[model samples]
Target: MTLLAIPAPAGWDLDLAHDYDDDLPPAGAEAPEQDVVAPDPAGLAAVGLDERTALLDAYVRGELGRVLHVAPGSIDVAGRTMNSLGVGSINGLELQARMEAALGIDVDLQRLLRANSAAELIDCLAGQLGPEDSPHKSAARRSTGTPAAAA
Candidate 1:
C-alpha cells in the first residue's frame, strides 16, 4: 500500500507529447501500444496456503509495476523477461528489498539476479519458503505451502 501520494510539480509538463523532442516514428507508421491494466487490490490482498503462490506472483508483479511506473496487471507476470520490463541491477535490487519486506522472507539476491523472467523470480523466492525451511516458514507464517514451481 502507498503511504504517500506525492503530487507532481505544478506547471511542468513532462509528457513525451508535450515537452520532449523525441524522434517521431515515420509518417503513417503506427506506434506499438501495450494495454495498461488497472491495479487489482483484491487480487493483491488474496491470502491462504493454497493462495500463497498466487500471492507471491501478485506481489512480484506489483513491485515490478511500481518500479517501472506501470500498472501491475499490465505485466506478463508469467512470461516477460526482467530485461524487457526495464529492471536493471539498481531497480532489481530495490525490487528484492521490497519483496523481502513484503513477503516476510529471506531472498537470495544472486538467485534473484539469475532469474530470466518475473515468473522465474517469483518461483525462486517462493520456493525458498518450502516446508523444509522452517525459519523461512515462520517468517512467512501467514500461510504454509510449497509455492508452485513455475516453468
Candidate 2:
C-alpha cells in the first residue's frame, strides 16, 4: 500500500489515505474474515498525540459549524481562521468554552486568542496533550507555567 501525505499545519499532518494494490484475486478465491475494532471514546484520553490532534480537528470543525450555523462539511476549517468565520471575542470565548467542555481539558484563553486559524488551534490543543518530551508542551509550559495534561 502506498500512503498519501496531505500537507496540513504542523502537528495536524497525517497520512491516512492509502492506495491499495491493484492486483485482484483469481475467480472463486475465498476471502478471509476480518475483525474491525471501533474507536473507544473512553480511551480517547489515553491516545497518543497524533490521534488527539485528529480528534481536536474534528471537534473544532463540528463546533465551528454549530456556532456558525453552517454545515460541518461546508466549513474549510483547516484553511480558515475563527475570525474569518465572523466570530468576535464573545463568540471566541463561547467556542473555547464549548471545546473545553467537550474535550474535558482546560485551555488558556490567551492561547485561543493567539491562534489565527483552525490548524493553529489544533496545534495548540495537541501540544497540551502531546508526549512529555514534546517541544510543544515545553513551550506551552514555559508560557503558562503549567504542564499540559496528557490526552
Candidate 3:
C-alpha cells in the first residue's frame, strides 16, 4: 500500500507540545463576581387545581390550534371534544405528548383517550397531577394579576 503525504495549510502549526500555562490566569487571581438570579417562584411551585386546569386549558387550546392549523380562539376548548373536533388518534397522541412535555409530567395514554372533550382532558390531567408533579402553583395566585411577592 502506498502512503500519501498531505501539506499543512498556510499559517497552520502542527506543534502539539506548546506550554499552556502562559494563557491561564495567575494562581491567586480571584474569580469575577456573578449575579445570582433566583428562579421565579410561580414557575417553581406546584399549581393549585384551578390554576393547573386553567393552564391546561390554555395549553390545550394552543396545541389544538397548532395541530389543526386553526386560530386558537376558534378551537372552543371548553365547548368541544376531540372526537367532535375531528382530531384523530394520531393527533390525540401528538397532543398528549405536547401536554406532557409542556407540563413536565407523564400522562396515561388510556386516560387521555378516554377524555371526550378538551375540558374533560384538562380535568383528567389535573386530577392526575400531584402537588409534586410540577412547579407552577395555584390559579388564584395567577388570577390576581400580580406576582405574590409584589402583592
Candidate 4:
C-alpha cells in the first residue's frame, strides 16, 4: 500500500515556531504601520533642477500656463528643450508659491534659496508629506473640525 501525504491547512506551516514553556499571553500581536519617508535629499535636488529646466522651456515655448503641472508622467520643464515665454527671477518666485500651495507645504522665498532646483524641492516636500505628516493635524488638534474615528 502506498502512503499518501495529506496537504496541511492554510497557515499551518509552524516549522519555525516554538512553544512556550509556561502559560502564553493572548494571540495576535499587531504591528503599527509606518509612514513613508523620502530616500534622501539628492532626489529632492534633482527634482528642483528639473523644475527650473522645465520652467525655462515653458517660458521659451510660450506655454508657461502648463508649467503648473510638473509631476512625473505629466508636463515636465526638464523634458522640454525650447520655449519663448521668458521665465525670469520674479516668475520663479511665483512658481514656487504656486507649487507650495498645491503641495500643502511651507515653501517660501527662504526655502527656495535652500533648494537650487525643482527636484530638490520635491524631496523636501516628500519629507513633509510623509504618511504621518498631515497638514490637517493642526486643525484636528484645535478641534476646528471633527474627523471620523478609525473603525
Candidate 5:
C-alpha cells in the first residue's frame, strides 16, 4: 500500500482505463499499465475506516493508475516500487490534489510536492495536518497504515 493519498496526478485517471486482468503478461511480455481498483467500502468500514479512508483509497488507486505501466487491474501493493521505477517523475501536484480531496481539507501542494515517496506524502500530510486536527487525516492514517510517529 502506497503512503500517498487520493486525487492523483493529471492523466492518472486514464491509467485505470483497463481493469485488473488475470492474464497479466510475463515480466517481459510488454510495457505494463496501471489500473485503479475501487475500494471495498464495506470491508474498510469493517476495519474501522472512515470516509477519508475511502477517499484515500480512491486517491491511491488513482496514483497507481497514474504511475504504473502495467494493466490497471494488475496493480498490487507489492508492485509500487516496480511501478515507480518504470515511470518518470511522479506527478506531485496531481497527488496533492487527490490527497486534499481525500481528506476533504485543503493541503499545501507546494509542501507536498517536496515529498519523494508515497509514504513521504503521507508523512507530509500528517505533519501538515495533525492527526487530531482532522478526522479525515486520522481516518486516512489508519486506513493507509501510516505510523503516528512518522506522521
Candidate 6:
C-alpha cells in the first residue's frame, strides 16, 4: 500500500452540525413555525415552593430542548414519552448535568433515564430541588397549571 503525504494545511468545516439528514421535512411541506417559550426569571424570585418548582419545570424543558436539538414548543412534553422524544442514556446525562448545575442539586443519571415522559423527568428534578416537594405535587402543578390541594 502506498502512503499519501499530508498537505501543509487542511480546510475544515467546524460549524455546528445543522445538516439533519434524517429530520428533513417532506417535500411540499413547510416546517411548523413556533417559538421556544422561556421561563420568566421573576418566577424564580417567588418564595413559595410551588413557584420555584414550576420554574424548575420550565428550565428542565429548555435544557431538554437544547439536548434534543429541538424547539421547546415543538413537542408536547407532557403528552409525549421520552423514548418517542429520542431521549437516551447519553443525552439523558447531558440533560441531567445541565439541570443539576443550574438547579444546584444532585440527580442520579439513572433516575433521569428511567423517566417515561418529559413531565416525569421534570418531577424528578423538582423533587430534588426541595425536601418537602413531592414529585406528584410538582406533576400536578405542571399538568393543571394550579397549586396542589393543600392538606
Candidate 6 local distance difference test against the native: 0.59
- Which tens-of-lDDT digit does each residue in 1-151 have in candidate 6? 9999855546765555767666887887855643335444334434356766677666776777777877776756688777688788888777666654455445667656666677876655444444344343332332335443310
Q: List the residue pairs that clash in candidate 6.
A: none
lDDT per residue for candidate 4 within 2-87, as digits (tens), equals 99998889988856456663464356643333222223323332354445334423332222343332222343334332122233
Q: Return the TM-score for candidate 6, rounded to 2 decimals.
A: 0.53
Per-residue lDDT over 100-131 for candidate 5, one digit per residue giving the tens place of the 0 to 100 score:
55444455554444335444443444333444
Q: In order, how many clashes per candidate? A: 0, 1, 8, 20, 15, 0
Task: Tell me the spans in candidate 6 whose CA falls farther than 4 Å from its real position.
Answer: 1-46, 131-151
lDDT of 3 at 39: 24
TM-score of 1: 0.52
Residue 23 in candidate 5 has what lDDT? 75
Candidate 2 runs further than 4 Å off: 1-42, 131-135, 138-151
Error of 5 at 147 (Å): 24
Query: By TM-score, is 2 or 5 better?
Result: 2
Query: Between which residue pairs do clashes occur in model 2?
Result: 45-151
List TM-scores for all candidates, in order.
0.52, 0.55, 0.52, 0.31, 0.34, 0.53
lDDT of 3 by residue, 1-151 (tens): 9999988999999877987798766899854432223222344346667876676666667777776666666876666667778677887787667655555455555555655677877665555442544443222233444432100
Best by TM-score: 2
Residues 31-83, candidate 1: write the lDDT tens digits: 45333342232333344334656766766777777877677888886666777
lDDT of each structure? 0.59, 0.62, 0.59, 0.39, 0.45, 0.59
True lDDT of residue 12, candidate 6: 62
Residue 55 of candidate 3: its Cα lDDT? 68
